[model samples]
Target: MAPSKPIITVVTGTGAQGRAISRAFHRSGKWHVRVLTRNPTGQVAQALEMEGMELVQGNFEDKGALLRVFEGAFAVYSVTIPPWHQQYDLSMGEYEQGVLQADAAKASNVQIFLFSTLPYVGPHFMGLGGVELYDG
Candidate 1:
């Protein structure tokens, strides 16, 4: 019999980076990938599910959901898009989501917490104006 694989919970699993990360882990055959997304029926979510990933329906703002998803997870990969990139308003700021996910991972005793973040160039960089960076 094959050994049981460790579980890794992935946040924003339907997005580009999340999809890639989840696929890599799933293809490795070493980790059981659990994906968290608000829409379980979305195309990307369905694709991942078909590939043997377990999907947990939830949003970042719901602490209870986050906690449930993190439970028994050996590692977590969290990635949140900027507000400007999102089509709808998020219940909390992007930074807040990061902090919340970290806290959830800690509470769940997860061994690894991987947070993907981008640097805010804002007005500091040339030709980048009118960009408001989300502050936790």
Candidate 2:
């Protein structure tokens, strides 16, 4: 049997950054791309699945689920959901989610891991030219 490619698990695989990262890994042909998302039946997730990526249905709030999501993976890439998406559920912010994922990655003994967060600029702030509305 031929040697298998390294696995790189991407969290939030249906989002913009996740999609880009997943695509880059697929294009390289050097690693098997695995994605974690809550909506595996969504169009984007289905598209990535069709492109040969393994999709793990999960959310960051559950570390146990994340550990499973990271299983058999050499690396994990994660970008916590941005502020805009948290409007409905304000229980956990991006930082909190990032920390949780980092802990899971460590526990899973992943070789490499990345955690990222991007602030959301509310629609009202878009009218203001060149101004960023960071809720810091």
Q: Each prediction's TM-score against the native?
A: 0.82, 0.83
How would you encode candidate 1's per-residue C-alpha lDDT over 10-86 as one tens digit per residue?
99888777888899999999999999998999999999999999999998777899999998999999886676664
lDDT of 1: 0.84
Which pairs clash inside model 1?
Answer: none
lDDT of 1 at 79: 85
> What are the runs in model 2 whose C-alpha is more than 4 Å off?
1-3, 86-90, 119-125, 129-136
Model 2 TM-score is 0.83
Predicted structure with the largest lDDT when compared to the true one: 1
lDDT of 1 at 84: 66
